[model samples]
Target: MTQPRVAKDWYESAGVRSGPRRMLEEDREFGLEVFPERLVPHLAHEGLADLGAEGRRALLTQHFYQYMLFTSHLETKVVNRGAALVAHGEVDIEVGPEARLDAFKIYSDEAYHALFSLDVVQQVEKVTATPVLPYDFGPRMARLDRTVERFLPDHGALGHLLQVVAFETVVTRFLAQIPRDEKVFRVVREVVGDHVRDEVHHHAYFSRFFKELWAGLPPRTRSEVACSMPHFVNDCLRPDLGPVRAALLSVGVPADRAEEVIRDCYREEMLVAGVRDAGRHTLALCETVGAFDFPEAREQLQLLGLAD
Candidate 1:
């Protein structure tokens, strides 16, 4: 049997020796001419050079802040709701005060993540003088949340548990990458790196919590949640290409070329591959817990090419 990872003593386990990190003036670069080429798949599109480095920087700058905006809003939902479930206890199981305290630590981390992600957005805004445009989570997450709410109208603890566990377990894909790429602004690297350090702990905490929560479910409820898990996982994994499309269009990318670029950038196989890689940890947990043992979940997984 695998030894379960512990979430307690987050300060030590999370390796956050230096305490919290934030974007500082030293981390800021004023009017950097080089835009992050890897910000999207449209890297080095035919129009970028014509956009010029400054123009390219502006577009990518807007893209950067808005991306943070959308995600930060949603993390509040996942973290707070998960915290409530932990604190209040669930249908068949109580997470207990000790566990709830740990959950609160995650809540603390996630809330700080939301706040700092906003601060990073503001930092970009101040430096670039470009405000975060009106952007929601886009169609994918909106639809997924609506559907999940309908499926589990009560936001049942089980439903919330599965959703939070699955997402937090997998978000390392995004959190881990943004900082490592030195192509963008120094502020981005610094802030996102700080965020990632905390998420390393959150991912570990949630992965451990997920297994325990899943094990706690009653058998019949487990089967029901199992059937719903794939759809939720797919929703969690699906990328919102719409934002990228709109970004290209706003940049005066030619209409046909914009559509073409979006398609080329997000090929079906490539998208699937990306999610399979990104969500590997969560998918594996779901599988070990027999999420795919049910026919409906298996079918969904198969349709996503995640299973046979």
Candidate 2:
């Protein structure tokens, strides 16, 4: 019997060598514009202060493990999808030069976000009685598993692009709303501001990419995508409610009301609003890219609770 071939590491794969190098070069140039050298340490310190010693440790631990998993998945997506683009000679060397530049800038920003998160996790772990890694929470673990299975398929270029749009949109909004503090909020503001600039372009790229994919699909496939969009939004917006519930329960909130309490928090509101914003922006992007009509797409987005 033939043995199944193991998937190779995306970064190390032959397909990723050139594209990543090109991507990296573009990033280096973009870095000159938004390095955040003056902002990161302050933000890191502020984020640390927001979490008490225990909370800081827990947050950092969660960020460390989650980022590792997320980066692994992203590397695979970039490598495989990039390889396919190369094979098809679909690489947009002309237009791609600009897109690659923007993507590289965003990638650099993400590295800082990941490192800051890891720092918090490590510090929290050292001081907390019971530090909680991301996977320690049931809902988060379940979502992570589901996300990997559903969106991280063998060939998911469109899905990968959507993932970027979804995440960046939320991060942008979340950063915008965090209460300003000289130490903490300042760093977040600077980092998020840089991210927002790059993400605007990233969102544009995904919007264009999705429209092309949607246009090429059969009518029936387009219908299927439209129908499935709500579920996708739900999955994307659902929070790690387990920890929130536990925190509430620990404080003597009734078990039945714990979930409700968590849902009522500002964080949940921000999540819903962010998802709605992404949905609207995505549709607008589709229109700009010449993929679909706004009226029709608006109806679909409304069904997903993204439109009023």
Candidate 3:
């Protein structure tokens, strides 16, 4: 027997012209140029203010090396999965044409994000002496592996949808908060812009999927998952500021000062705004799916310092 043909549409399955594509074009046209002239001095000044001069330089070096590795690893995984999905077009098998188009747009965005991350890695290596280590999120990856084993197998399609929705929501939240003034921030923002654009579609696609899943779940199971969501969100929001901090401390900044700097960076109003937007988006998703009340999610938001 032959496999069934999947439906394609001009806007959905035809190509990658969408929000992400527009953002990429905007970046190419208007994006700030990052280089040693602006970047090195910015790092030096910021580091000096936060950690003493030495600590500042050290943290910059650490960040240069560590972020390259970390983002590279993350982008690689995202690209592989996104490429596979796009190539196979299997995810849209059950969904409507609109959803498939949205998913395709997301896949294209992921590809761009992955390529942008790789480009940043190369750029950092060219300008800095920091050595790239053969390491990344060792403990976290192990934990995710175990969690996937425990949760992914039993949740069926619904479980998978929930996980994807939650993760994409959180990632979009983070990408939207990145600072834009610093050279590093600019580079990071460009890469993340792609992710943010793509994630909007992913969130939409999963919202529909979550609704279907939620309607079918037994009340007891629904309650169990709802209760667990706060902890899950907390774990996801735990910022890995270690690399940033280590970089500062390496340059001779006192540990206390480094901590203060990290806190200040995260405490910016823009970061808070991003958190609020993300929380609202997640709450909206919850409303759509009829999973749990906003009050329950608000508690989680408070735990993450995203709400009062």
Best by lDDT: 1
* lDDT tens per residue, model 1, 237-265: 76677667677667677788778877777
Q: List the residue pairs that clash in candidate 3.
A: 12-101, 54-251, 55-251, 59-247, 59-248
Superposed model 2: Cα runs more than 4 Å off: 1-112, 123-133, 136-157, 168-174, 177-201, 211-220, 229-231, 250-257, 263-274, 287-300
Query: Per-residue lDDT for 165-211 in model 3, tens only?
Result: 45555544333555443443355455555555455555555555556
Better of 2 and 3 by lDDT: 3
- Please identify which of the two predictions, 1 or 3, would achieve the higher lDDT against the true structure: 1
Q: Rank the candidates by TM-score, best first.
A: 1, 3, 2
What's model 1's lDDT at 183? 56
lDDT of 2 at 22: 12
Which prediction has the highest TM-score against the true structure? 1
Against the true structure, candidate 3 has what lDDT?
A: 0.48
Local accuracy by lDDT, each model: 0.66, 0.41, 0.48
For all predicted structures, in order, the TM-scores are: 0.84, 0.50, 0.59
- Candidate 2 lowest-lDDT run of ten: 1-10
